[model samples]
Every structure is written in structure tokens, then in C-alpha cells.
Target chain A: MTTYYLEYLKLKKKLRSWLGPIIVFILIMVAYPLTVEFLEKDLEKGFYSLLWISILLSMMFSTEDIFLEDFNDGTLEQIIISSSSFPFMIAKKIFIYWIMIGLPISALSFLFSLGITKDLNLSLFVIFLAMISSYIFLNLFVFGSALSLNKGSVLGALITMPIALPVLIVLGKSIIALQFGINYLELLLLLLGCLSIIISTVPFIVSYVIKAHLE
Target chain B: MWGLFFTPEDFVQGNSYRIIYLHVPASFLSQSLYAAMAIASVIYLVWRVKLAAYLIISIAPIGAIVTFIALFSGSVWGIPTWGTWWQWDARITSTLILFIMYLGLISLHASFSNYEKADKLLSWLVIVGFVNIPIIKKSVDWWSTLHQSASITLTDKPSIDPSMLYPLIGSIIGFFGLIICLVILSSYVQILKRESTKSWLKDYV
Candidate 1:
């Protein structure tokens, strides 16, 4: 268990490599909102547009981290052979990822949401939804990157995007509902339920794929 | 087979509800075929059964085709009732999503070269994909605007009329029979492709 904590620290130390994808993705996040404004000519459109693009871009970037270093260096093989509980350990790594990558982006999205919705309550919901949505994307990315470890980012996007679309629609609908003062609890619960289901299952899938590829 | 020819027509829908004979069966197999793929995947992962892996490989394209059939029939049925070829309704959207996921599985399976590693990855894809079934099933009941509530469930008494219900039952059975035949044919060819040098193929090849 503590070993996973050490793995998390080593992963964070590798952030310098991610700087490129992060900067580029953040630029996209900021730029996409401008397009939304051009259509509606409304600044508030920035909030929802930012949240959606940011969550997706964050996912696209962070997923690159899932198997890159370990697989590239042959460390993943040794780790898999040593640990009987690879999936749980990987789950911990995902949690740490959510903390490092997902949390900051969620916070940024919340600030943007506040600018668009102009409602503190809805913005906060945006933050909460951002976090859970990121968690979903991260887990799905873990699955995608494991399969596409050598296949490149296009395959990763191809694999995860279709699976993530339904979840995205649910989250987007709830956010839009919140903006309109519609009751959102049902949608919120549904989103959370789907999140929990993804949480419990995806790690095991990733672990099996990782082990298989390592072998 | 008897029910297909014998069922009474819906008063409002006239003969168009007849599409349900094809639509409902395709939808049922589309969803169940996914479950079968997931189960085959689970069996392959746990046991490393080559046959189960073949099931996973063969099941995907079949699942995709059935998903397409369901969508096609639903859209055909939709044109008369909804006055549009496609509506962004919840049930309809989820089914489209389901079809795309099946396509993802096929693409992912095709991308890899190593049969052994591919089997594991394929199983992983199907098992992870099992999550979509419930979302698709409940989408209509959860949101009320478009697509009507499901008229039949395994446990609940079907809300459908008996005259109409019997044909649906026959169509579902017939569809399953057809799918089973197709699966057997595909799996046999796949095995031959993979095991062409084996002694078992001496008899057939």
C-alpha cells in the first residue's frame, strides 16, 4: 500500500515531461471557449465550453502518462511480477492522478464556470461535476492507454472517446439543467452511479491488459 | 415462425408495427450478444481458453451488425411515428452509442498483431463495455419525452397485447437461432484460419 504512495511520488516527479502536453491542452481549453462566444456572442458560453474541452483535453494529455514511462523503461514488467495486487495498486495511482491532474483542472473549470453562469451554486456544481467527470475520463484513459501503449494517441482517442460519450452527455445535460434551475439531483445521482461502476471495474481491466502486454 | 404470419396488427400503427417483428428481435440480440461477448471475455481472461477468445473475436462484428439492424429497424419504425428519421432521444442515442462501442471493440481487436496479448486486451474491452447495457436499457424510462417505456421485461408481465406478443416471442427465438447459426459458421472459419496446420483440419480442409 505504501509502495503505491511511493509510486505516486515518483510519478509526480516525472511531471516535467508532461509540461508540453499540458501547455498545449490548456491553450486549447482557453481557445475553444472563444469559438463558443463567436456563435452565441455570449461570454457566459465560455463556462460550459471550457469545462467540456478542459476535461477532454486533460484526459487526452494525462492518459499519455498512464503507461508511458513504466512501459518504456521495462519497469512495469518487474512491478507486475513482484506484486500480486497489481490492480489495486494501479487504482491508487489513478487516485493520485486524479489529485494531481484532475483536481487542478477541476478548480480551473470552476473559475471559468463562475464567469459564464454567474452563479456561485452552479459553478460549484461545475467543479464537482468536473472532478467526477475527470475521474471517469482518467479511468477510461487508463484502459485506452494500456491498449494503445505503442499504438499512439490516435488509437487512445479512438478507443476511449466512444465509451466516454454517453457519460459526457449525462454530465453535460446535468450541467445544462443546473444552469436553467431545473432539478438536477436525479441526473447527478445517475452520473455518480455510473462513476462508481467505472471506478470498481476499469482498474482490473487495465491491470490485465498491462500484465498481458508486459509479458 | 407461425407467430410472424399470425399476429394481429396494431390499430394505430396499422402494418408498420409489424416492423417490431424484426426490430424487437434485433434489439434483443444486440443487447444480449454484448452480454455473451462479455461472458466469453470473462471466461477467456480467467481461464485463457482459446475457444473463448475466438468467441470474443467472432462475437464483436456480429454484435456490431445486430446493433446496426436494431438501429436501422428503429429508425424505419421512427419515420412514421416520430415524423423524423432520427431524433436525439435518450434510447436512440444510447443505442447509437452502443453500436459505436462495438465498432471500437472491433477496431481495437484488429489493431493488434499478437494473438495472445490481443485476447487479453479484447476480453478487457468487452468486460469494461458491459457497463453500457444498463444505461441503454434504462434511458427511455429515465427520460420521458421521446421513445416509449419498454413494453416487456423478463420478470415483469409484458404490457403488450397477447396477439402482438406471440410474434415478438417467435421473432426473438428465430433471431437467436439465426445468430447462433451465424456464430457457429464464423467461429468455425476463424478456427480454420488459425489452426489450418492442425490435424483436426485434415478432415475438413
Candidate 2:
């Protein structure tokens, strides 16, 4: 537990360095819906879609830094050699990623929803599911980003997007369902299932790739 | 499988419908190749196996070609059956995305001079992208997509009649064989390119 806290602190410190600009970006994303709403009041659905789109794109942008810095600074090498297991280290990094990127973006999503749709209840639920699902999505993204650390960022984006299409589709559908007040339990279940699978599989894959690259 | 390949059949649309033989197998082989690449990627990542990277890269182009054939033939088949060139059906969209993913892999490889970096990156991409293939395959079932239902299953006999089955199975096997040959040939080229010294390459040049 002490070790976990230490790891968390280390990640939090690293993340704090990037938090300011990221927060400003989240604010901009949140304000997008207000602008769209002002431009066309009836464009509510479009505003909602745009909100999710911005969140997705913002997350993608923030994730580019996931491994690029580590790879450049040789920190990744040290992490691999640390007494802490590779998976634990990666999990901690992903946890930091979630806190820094996913949580703020989700909050922005909720704020955008309220601005556009003016329904606090549905907006909150939508944000809840979006946050949960995006955590899983970012897990997969960071895993891929870690894999592609030596590759350029654009290449990482290309490789990760298609793999992420299903998640996107499900998230979109669930959001739509939420808007319409329909039951989205099945979609949530599917997202959770996918999240579980990636969580189980990704650490091993990341460690393996890192080891392979080091050699 | 061989027994299923021995029967004969005719399509109501005549010989053109025979394209089904190519289309079905090409689609199947493409998906299987991606699946194999995914597994190879997993092995590479899990074991740090260099061989798996070679296998993944070798398979990408062949998978791209197979996906192309599947989409082209599906488009042709659509013109006859659905009276249009294309539909935003689940199967078509998924296959298109699959093709795009393959191209993405190919482009990533080409974009990098650092082979080691490219291999590691592509391997990771392959594993991550693999999650989509299953979803694509099952999309027709999971969503109200306008794609045809899956024809082959183990628990149930194929929905395709025995008449159509023989040629379909034969074409599938033949396509698989052809893809294997193509991949092996390409892999040899990659190996030579990667391992040969400048003098060795110059000798050939």
C-alpha cells in the first residue's frame, strides 16, 4: 500500500507538470457547445455529438505524450528495471492518465451537456458512463501508445483508431440511448466486458514489447 | 472440409455469381490473416519474439489485398442483388475499416527507417486493432446492421446449400494457399532487404 501511494505520488507529480495546459484545453472543449448552442438553438443533438467528439479528440491528443517523453528521456528503460513490476508501473501511469485526461474531459462533457441540453440528470449519467468507458478506451490507447513509443505520434493515431472503432460505436450508441431515456444496460455491459479484456491483456503485452525493444 | 468441396452447384445469375467463390474466401482469409497477425503480435509482445514481428509485417500486405478483393467482389455482387453498387451495411463498413487498418500498418512500416521501432510499434498496433475484427464479425448479430447473417457455423450446418458449397470451399482453400505463397515470398524479400549489407545489395544491383 505504501509503495502504491509512492507510485501514485510520483505519477501525480509528473502529471501536475502538464495539468495547466490540459485544463485550459478542457475549458475550451466545454465552451464549444455553448458557442454551437448560441449559433443554433435547435442544434442540440449536434452539440451533444460535438461534445463527445471533442472529448474523444482531446483525449487522443493528450495521450500522445504517454510514452514519447519516457522514450526520449530514457525513463522508460529505468521503469522496466525498477523493483516494481512493469504492469504495476503501467497501471499507475494509466491511472494518472485517467485522472489527468479522462476525468477532466468527462467533467467538461457534463458541463457541455448541461450547456447544450439543459438536462442535469441525463447529462450526469451520460458523463458517468462516458467517464467509465473512456477510462477503458484510454487504457487501450495508452497501451498502444506505449507500444508505438518509438514510432511517430501520427502513426500511433492511425494504428489505434480502427481498433478503437467498436468502443466509439458503443459509446455513441449509449449516449444516444441516454438522451432518449432508453435502457443502455446491455451497451454498458459490453463496454465493461471489453474493458476487462483489455485490462487483463494489455499489461502483459506492454511489458513484452518493452522487453523486446530493450533487447 | 475436403468432403464439403466435392459437390457442385449453379447460381441463378449464371457464371458471374461464381465470384462468390472468390469473395467469400478472400474475406475469410483476410480476417483469418488479421487474426493470425493479432496472435503473432501477442506472442511478440509477450515473449519479445522477433519472429512474430516478421510474421506480422509479412501478413499485412496480403491481408490488404484480400480485403480489397472481398470489397470489390462484394460491390459487384451488390450491383446484382441489391440493385446498387454499395450499401452502408455492417459487413461492408467493417470490411472497409479492416482494409484501412491494414493500410495503416503498411504505411507505418514504410514511414519508418528504424526497423526495430517500426516492428515494435506495428506489433502493438496489430494487437490493439485486433479487438475490432471480432466486433466487426459479430456486428451483424449485435446491431441491426444490414449485413447478411453468418453462413458457416460448427454447431449448425452451413446455410449455403451443398451445390454452392463445393466451389466456395475450393476457392477458399485455393485463396488461402495463394495468400500463404504470397506472404512467404514477400517475407523473403523483407529478410533480404533487412539483413543484406550494402555491398551485397550492390552486387545484386
Candidate 3:
């Protein structure tokens, strides 16, 4: 457990060093609002809509970092050789990656929501759901990135996103509903079910693929 | 078997219904091709079998062609029966998505110059996208969707008339044979391309 936290901290440091989170924040938090404001007169629908869209794109941008850098730098091999279990290491890396990427994006999304909808509670709900969905998505993305370690970035995203579509659709719809103040309990449940599946299954999938790639 | 080949005397659509021969088979082969891709992807992921990658690349274009035929014929059939060029029926929509997945695989494979990376990426996509096929197939049945139910199956006789069934089965067999031939031929080409740098490919190339 302590090891996992330490590994998580190390990953967070690496992500910060890579400057991915900073660029993603600027793209989602700052640039998105400016674009929406420029596009529409009302800026209400445009603001809320672009906020979610920015979150999705930012998640995608960070996914490429999942395995590529480690594969390139040979740190992945070192982690595999470490006393720490490989699956645990992978879970830590994914968790940290999701935290660094999803957390800030979700925070910005909440602020964006406040700016657009002007309802703090609803904004928090939207951010909460988005954060959960993004966590599941990042796990699946990490699994795919590991499996397709040899594949190029664009192809990897294409492969992963289709499988991840159900989750994304449910999340997107729920966020839309939340913004509109509609009851979206069913969509929320569906997204939660998907998140549960990812949590339980993704580690095994990642481990199996990593082992296969090593061989 | 002799009677099976003979056309029914009381046929309504006439010999042009014979196109069902081509259409049905193409549909069957397309589904089979997707199934094969799914299975190959699983094996590749599980066992890291390079041959599965070759099989995926070989079958994808053929699958795309089969899917195209299915949509084209369905549109043609729709014109006569549904009084329109196309409808957003469950079967059509699902099949369209399947076609998109195939196109996705083809484009993904072509995007990469490195053959090895292309194989890995496409295999992953194939595995992931194949999960949606069953969902697409049952979406109509599960929901009050517009698509028609499946035609032929193990426990059930086909819903269509005998006049339609015979040619449909014949075309299906022919299409299967043709697709098999194409897969084998293309797989040979793939082998040649990949192994061409080898001394053995030198003999063939």
C-alpha cells in the first residue's frame, strides 16, 4: 500500500515533468471558454457543451502518455523487474495518471459549469460523474495502451475508444442531463456498472498483455 | 440434392431473386469474417500469435466487401418492399456500424508504415470493436428497435419461402467458397510481403 502510494507519487512527478497536465489545463480550462464565448452570443449552451467536450479531448490527449514514454525510456522494464507486483504497479500508474489528468480537468469542468449553469450543486454532480467515468476510461485506455504497445498513437486511440464508447455515451448523456437539471439516475447507474467492470477486469487484462509483450 | 438445385415453378420474384444467392452468402460470410477476426484477435492477445495478425489483415478487406454487398442488396430489397431506398431499421443500422468498424480497421492498418505496429494496433481494434457486433445484432430484439430479426439459424427454419431459400443457400455456399479462396490468396500475398526479405520469399517473389 505504501509502495503503491510511493509509485503513484513517482508517476505524478513524471507527469508533471512531462508538462502534459499543464498543457491539458490550458486547453480545457482557459482555451475552451474563450472559444465558446467567441462562437456563441448566449454562451450558455456553448459554454457547458464545450466544457464536456474539452474534458473528453483532454483525456484522450493524456492517454498517449500511458505506456509510450515508459516503453521508450526502458522504465517499464525496470518496473517489471522490481519487487513490487506488476499489476499493482500498473494500477498505481493508471490511478496516478487518472488523478493527475482527470482531477484537474474535473475541477475545471466544475468551475466552467458554475460559469455556465450558475448552480454549484449541479456543477459538482457533473464533475463527480465525469471524474468517475474518466477513471474507468483511463483504466481501459491504459490496458489498451499496454496491449498495443507496439502500435502507433492514433491507432491505439481508435481501438480503445470504440470499446470505451458505451461508457463515454452514458457519461456524456448524464452530463448533458445534469446540466439541464434532468433526472439521469439510469445513466449514472450504467456508468457506475461500467466503472466497476473496469476496476475489476482491467488489471488482469493489463497484466496479461504486459506479460505477453515481454515474451 | 438434385431437387435442391432446381428452381421452384411457382416462384414470385423470379430468377432475379437469385441475387439472394449472392446477397445471403455475402451476409453470412461477413458475419463469419467478423467472428474470425474476433477469434484471431483473442488468440493474438492471449498467445501473441503473429499469424493471427496476418489473418486479421487478410480478412478485413473481404469483410468490408461482404458488408458492402449486404447493405447494397438490403437497399435494393428495400426499394421494392419498403418503398424507399433505405430505412434506419435495426439490421441496417447495426450492419452499418459493422461496416464502419471494418473501415476503421482498414484505415488504422494503412495509417502505420511499420507493418508490425500496424498489426498490433489493428488486432487490438478488431478485438475491441467485435464486442459491439453482438450488441448491434440484439439491439433490435432487446429494444423495440426497427431492425428485422435474424433470418436462418440452427433451431429455426428460415422465415422466407422455399423459392427464396434454395438460391440463398447456394449463393451462401458459393460466397463462402469465394471468400475462403480470397483469404487464402491474400494471406499468401501478405506472407510474401512480410517474408519477402527472407531467402524463402526470394524464391516466390
By TM-score, the best candidate is 1
**Which 10-residue window in model 2 chain A sums to the lowest lDDT?**
A16-25
Per-residue lDDT tens digits for candidate 1, residues B1-205, read 5555667767898777888889898988889999999999888878878999998888889989999999999999989888887988788888888898889888887888877777788788787777789888888877775788889988999999988887788888989999999999889888887787788788776
- lDDT of candidate 1 over A82-200, digit per residue (tens): 84578887888888788777877788777766655567998788888888888888888888888878877567666677678777778878877887889999998988987898899
**lDDT on C-alpha atoms for all candidate structures:** 0.80, 0.74, 0.70
Candidate 3, residues B27-67, lDDT tens digits: the string is 66777899999899888767988888888999999899989
Share of real interface contacts recovered by each model?
A: 0.55, 0.81, 0.23
Clashes per model (N, Cα, C within 3 A): 0, 0, 2
What C-alpha lDDT, on a 0 to 100 scale, does residue A118 get in candidate 1? 65
lDDT tens digits, residue span A1-215, model 2: 67567645755676543464356556766566456546546657566556555655666666676766677788778978878688777776777677766787777678767766788887887777668766776776666566556765556666677776667777778878876779988888888888878777777777766675666
Name the runs in model 2 displaced over 4 angstroms: A1-42, A179-182, A200-204, B1-16, B42-52, B111-117, B195-205
TM-score of predicted model 3?
0.72
Candidate 2 residue pairs in backbone clash: none
lDDT string, candidate 3, A86-147, tens digits: 77777777777776778777776777677766777878787878688678767866765665
Candidate 3 achieves a global lDDT of 0.70
How far does residue B5 in candidate 3 sit from its true spot (Å)? 15
How do the candidates score on chain B by TM-score?
0.94, 0.87, 0.86
Model 1 chain B: lowest-lDDT 10 consecutive positions: B1-10
Each prediction's DockQ against the real complex = 0.50, 0.52, 0.26
Candidate 3's displacement at residue A104, Å, is 3.5
Docking class of 2: medium
